[model samples]
Target: MSHHAKDLLTLAKAVIDTEIAALAALPSRLDDDFLHACETILACQGRVIVTGMGKSGHIGNKIAATLASTGTPAFFLHPGEASHGDLGMIVNGDVIIALSNSGTSEEILAILPVIRRLNVRIIAMTGNPQSSLAQAADFHINTGVDKEACPLGLAPTSSTTATLVMGDALAVALLEARGFTANDFARSHPGGRLGKRLLVHVRDIMHTGTEIPQVPPDASLQQAILEMTRKKLGMTAITTPNGTLLGIFTDGDLRRSFEKGQSLHEQPISALMTVSFRSINAHNLAVEALNLMQEYAITVLPVIQDGSVIGIIHMHDLLRAGIA
Candidate 1:
C-alpha cells in the first residue's frame, strides 16, 4: 500500500479499537437498574417517551423506532421542544427514557420536573453515574464510555455507539419479555420483506376458479397437457368427477411418458399421475409452500380444501409475491 493509504488505515483502526474497548465495558455495567427498566416498561400502561438533545437526540430517535417496531409502544420526543409546550405529549403512567451524556443537559433537566408532575416514571441513560440526572431518575442505566474515538476526545463517536447498543439491548430484552414473535414483527412491518415471508398466505396469490389447471381422473393425457399449456403452470391437477384432488401430472411426467413412447391420446392421465404428493392449505404461509416445493423438487402445488382442489400455486407465484 501507498504511504498515505497506510496512514489512513492506521487512523481508522485506532478509532475502531477504542470503540471496541468501550463496548467491552458495557456488559459488566448491566445491573439491577437495567432489570428494573425492562420490568417498568413491561408494566407501563402508556407508551415509552424517549427524550434527549443533539447527538443524544439522534440516538434516542433510533432507539424509539426499534422499540416500537419490536412490539413496544414508544416514540421519540425532543427535550428542547418539550420546554415550549411539546411536553403536552406526556401523560400519566407514561415511561420516560432520558438520554444525556453528561447527565446534565439543561434541556432535558428543564422538563424533568414537569414530566414528574404527571406521574411519569423516569429512566436515565447517561455517562456519569453521579450526575444530577442519575440522582433525579427513578432508575439509571449506564452507557459510560472510557473516552471518545475523536482525535481531540470530544466528538460523540464511542459514547454514542455505546448508547445505541444499550438502547438495542433494552428493546430486545423487553421484546423477549413480552414473548414477541416473528408474526408480531411482521404485523408492524407489513410492507417489508418479513411481512411477505411471514404474513403472505398461499391463498393470497394462488390461482383460483378457471385459472386453476385441472382435469378429471379419466381425462386423456392429451387433454391434461392442453390444460397445463393454456394455464402456463407446467402442471395440471387430476381430480375426480366431483373435483376431489386424486393426483397431479406435471411436465416431468410428460417427459418420462414421452421417453417411453406411450400413446398420449389413448392413455388416461391418472395412470401416470403422482398419487403421493405434497399439498398445502390455502391458509398456510406462502413461505411454507416454498419449502414444500423445494423439499419435493416440484414447481407447482395444489391447494386442497374440503378434499377438493381449490387452487394451484406455482413457483412463479412465490417469486412474484417476493416469498421465494
Candidate 2:
C-alpha cells in the first residue's frame, strides 16, 4: 500500500519464516529425554513444579496452566523466589521442570542443591543440551534454536515459541497416557462453554409439566394456536389423552395450512401437524438436542420417552443454558 507499509509486511513475514524454521526443527530434538520426561511426570505422585527465570518464567507459567488444565497437577514457581523461602515448596515425590535458555541462570542454579537434597527428580529444558543444568538433570528437553526471529537477536522469540511447543507436547502426551476424556476436561472447566455443552442435560433446561405446550390430536387448529400463544414456544405438541406424543404443530405448519386456504377454525391440529417429529430424551445432552434441532432445521423439539411427552426444549433454552 505504501513504502513504509511494504517494509513492515516484509519484516513481519521474515520474522514468521524464521520462527517457522525454528519450530520445524524442534520435533527432531525430541528423543528418549522427552519420553523420559513424560514417563517421570506420569509416575509422579506429587504435582509438577515448573521453574524458570525472566521470559522463560512467563512461558513456564503458561506451560504450568496448560498442564494443570489437561489433567496434570502442575504450577509455576519463579526461580528467583525459589532461591528464597519458596524453595520449601519442593518436597519428596515431586518433580521439577527447570527452564533456562542459557542453562545456567543464577536464580535457577541456586536451587539445584536443595532439590537434590530433597530427593526430587529434575527435568531440565535448555537451549544447549550440553549445558551444566542438562547434564545434571534426570532428563533434558532441548529447545535450542539456531537463531532468533528478532533481527537484533536479543529478544527471546523463536526460542520461547519452541519451549512453549515442547511444553504443550509434554502435556498432551500425558493427557493421552491418562486417557483424559472430554468429560474429564469439562469437569476441570466447569464455568466454560465446553463444560456447559457436556454437563448440561436436556432435563436441566427442558420445559416440563404445564410449561410445555401440548394438546390432543382432536384439538382444533385454533385450540393448538392458543396453546402455542399461552406457552410462547412457537409450537405445540399433539399428545393422546394418556400423554402419548403423536405429532407437533409449529408456525411452519400453520403457514402451510393457511397457504392452502384451510379453515383454521374448524381444521383439527393433527390434519396439519408434522408426524415425523424429532425428539430428545431428558437424560441426553442439551447440546445433542441442539444438534438435532439444527439437523432438522427446527427451533423446538418435544422430549419424549417411550412414546410419552414428558418435556419440551426450545432453542432459546439451549442458548440460555450456554449449550448452543
By TM-score, who's the top model here? 2
Q: Candidate 1: where are CA atoms >4 Å away?
A: none
Q: Write candidate 2's Cα lDDT for 40-101 as tens digits.
A: 99999999999998899999999999999999999999988887688888889999999988
**lDDT values for all models:** 0.94, 0.92
Tell me, by lDDT, which candidate is best: 1
lDDT score for candidate 1 against the true structure: 0.94
Candidate 1 per-residue lDDT, tens place, 70-150, comes to 999999999989988898999998999999999999999899889889999999999999999999999999999989999
Q: How many backbone clashes does candidate 2 have?
A: 0
List candidate 2 segments past 4 Å from native.
none
RMSD, one per candidate, in order: 1.5, 1.3
Q: lDDT, candidate 1, residue 168? A: 98
| lDDT of predicted model 2 | 0.92
